[model samples]
Target: MAIPKYHELRISALRLLSDGRSMKLRDFLEPLANEFKLTDEEINEMYPSGNGHIFYDRISWALSYLNMAGLLDKPARGIYKISKKGVTMFNSETPEYINEFVDKEVAKRDKIKKNKNPEIKIIDLNDRQTPQEGLYTSFNNIRNSIYEEILTTILTKTPAAFEKLVVMLLQKMGYGGEIKNSGVVTKQSNDGGIDGIIKEDILGFGRINIQAKRYRLDIAVGREEIQRFVGALAVAQSNKGVFITTSYFSKGAIEYVENLFGNTTVVLIDGKNLASYIYDYGLGMQVEQTIEIKKMDTDFWDSMANQ
Candidate 1:
């Protein structure tokens, strides 16, 4: 069976502590996995960022929500026990109960904020995703929309502008040291297949050749195109090359570069990755706003209590 969503884990987690036994947060993993009959693969599935186990993360969020809603009590660090309210909730509440509680809590907090400052706005909550998850999802969505806009804007520019942009992006990424004229876009004519070059040092002892293709989104840069770029690298006597395109590469093109046996190395940057790099490196983009998410500092409170 598919792994249960974090919200779905709420009632099950409450049920686990319904017997009045205190369990460390880690202790809940095994029994919950067993109760859900989750496969080993499902239990160990990871987030896209590969930071932590997905199932374990969901479980932690479930416990946190229960604790916040006054259904669970934390008597010691990393340990949790069901409260009298939790036992009552386990017997009476349905799976959807946590969502209603969270919405009400958010409304209450917003109400308090509005009383202090009349301009305060109520926050919208997604029943299926925790706040952190929703924030990341919204961030990714905005970034993806910007990527489409970036590609469309790039396509509107001349081919020479695209070549210069690629070179500038590499320079911004610190490919070349701080040296004047370290990166240059070659003249349109008699430049061979290479469109740009980056001198890796002040003396121009090492260099990286660049080939930028401003192709339509539907176009796929094929093996022959990559071969020509490699040949251009050979002519320039440079062993490193970057083949960037506003379109994706064909399977054969990718495999050809992968299986090459020599000092020459080529890196392919496709449309999606190209846009992401531009956004990440702050190339031709500006930060319009910044939002900071803050959490309680438990250690500060612990130190104060001891003092």
Candidate 2:
């Protein structure tokens, strides 16, 4: 069965912490998951955004809402305990009443925020997004948030780290011919803008030059940069080049690569595409869950009826 809605998750979380013990979020998740009798497959299911497991994500959101309502206390990051109010609610009423309590609390907070800023809007946090379209929109929003975090984390790493990440990704995509000597980062001179070299085959009959740019997400890679990389490829007498950046390329830059009708081939990869590759190849990310959706087989049913 599917996990409960957001408010229900809040109720479950509070009941689990009613003993007044400060529980780590990681530890609390186990019992909460067990209470629902969720299979390992169900627990591992991921959201469409591929950022996190759906079960864990919903549980985290429930904890956030409960904290906002003053029913839960966070003594430290990822560690939560039930508040006096939460204990009272647990003892006096059914978990369903927590929904009403949370609604009032959220409304009060939104009203306070609205007084300070008229532009702010308060939305109904429960049961409004039940349809498929609403579900997709919500999933996309979560995915976008995750993408922002990935870019921010990438910015904090060294340029060499980014280079190594790209190499690892290409190798996973089957670009590096063999395990040993598949690719090497040219540290000695920037090699006229080339950061690394990848061999196409084990025999080294062909090679590809790689230029990695750790540009800020807001910045755009221009045609001039691509041209310089092309010149570097020429200097090295290589016909293949890959120009990758943690930012997007301008229209002119893309057109330049498309119109360059010669032996040289330059493939451009931007920030969004880069992150997608990282996710797909599991380079820096891990599998949180795998979910499978089953559809009815009309042909099999029809055959049974005919029989």
Candidate 3:
């Protein structure tokens, strides 16, 4: 497997817990390694695929959700047990279909809450928000902005520099992209689209090849461009190519890339991806300043209200 999709990891965690052992996250993770045939370090290195760790967070939320909804139960903190509800679910399912089950439970919870609450749940828009909500919004916005900056930065740099920037950006997002923004990579003379490669796990080493392109948003990459990149991969006898572009791929371009070959494979990354990489890595963000500040002073507030 190139990378185990994070939802798979969540389901794996639950299946491990269902073993009737009181397990910590550490314990739960071991079976995942055995199942995936990976080491502990590999599990630690696998980052979430989308929305940063929110996908993993969603998985964690799903676990709690299953427990709360009575599909699973907790015997203790850090220990989860499959309830009768869970057993019924397990017997009727296959591993590939677990996500559907989690989604079902999530829906079930929403329906139950609606029946009991009846009134609209109080949700304040961020314009008038709770401290927790405000913090989440602020951080997420900062992360989004950083991704845009990275794409734009690449657009402005030389193609030679784009490869290094992409690696640095990946490292910033927390992927193990070992890149010195300036070295001649493995097939430096002959390889076409490939910049330096990034391997999240040694398992992914031969399975992945990454190509970087820097362009203005208006420039649309077409299928021929993708085909050329794929040909470069073939020269290296590689299985996959990731074409990362700062501009969008034409719809025809996307369809053409996917259908380009039966055994050959390529993944297209356009402007949207360029931004996501930045956000995923927390790229271009540094702590500029911080201050210890007082929260609302009760007396000051009271005086203002009286006046």
Maximum-lDDT candidate: 1
Off by over 4 Å in 3: 1-131, 168-190, 198-207, 282-307
* Residue-by-residue lDDT tens digits, candidate 1, 1-307: 8989887887888888989999987888999999999999999999776767999989987887677677898776578999988888677876577568754664575476458446333334545777787777667656765786689788988999999999999999999878889999999998899999999988998999999999998799999999999999988988999999998999999999999888999999999889999999999899966777898999887778463
Show the colliding residue pairs in model 3.
172-281, 173-281
Pick out the ten consecutive residues of candidate 1 with the lowest summed lDDT: 117-126
User: What TM-score against the true fold does each predicted structure earn?
Assistant: 0.59, 0.59, 0.43
Weakest 10 consecutive residues, lDDT, candidate 2? 116-125
Tens digit of lDDT per residue, candidate 2, span 3-104?
Answer: 766666888788788899888767756898889888888888886668678888788878878888999987755679999988888899876678888878
Model 3 lDDT per residue over 1-307, tens place = 3335555665666666665655554454445557778655554553333233333344455566566556677665546677876777666777556666776766676566447446423233536877766766656545544555566556667776777766666556555545333222335475566785655554554445677777787799887887787787888678766778898898888898767756787877777667776655556555543434357888877878453
* TM-score: model 2 vs. ground truth: 0.59
User: How close to the true structure is residue 25 of candidate 1, measured as C-alpha lDDT?
Assistant: 73
The order of the candidates by lDDT, greatest first, is 1, 2, 3
lDDT values, one for every candidate: 0.85, 0.80, 0.63
Q: In terms of TM-score, how similar is model 1 to the real structure? A: 0.59
Error of 1 at 114 (Å): 38
Candidate 3 overall lDDT versus native: 0.63
RMSD of 1: 21.0
Better of 1 and 2 by TM-score: 2
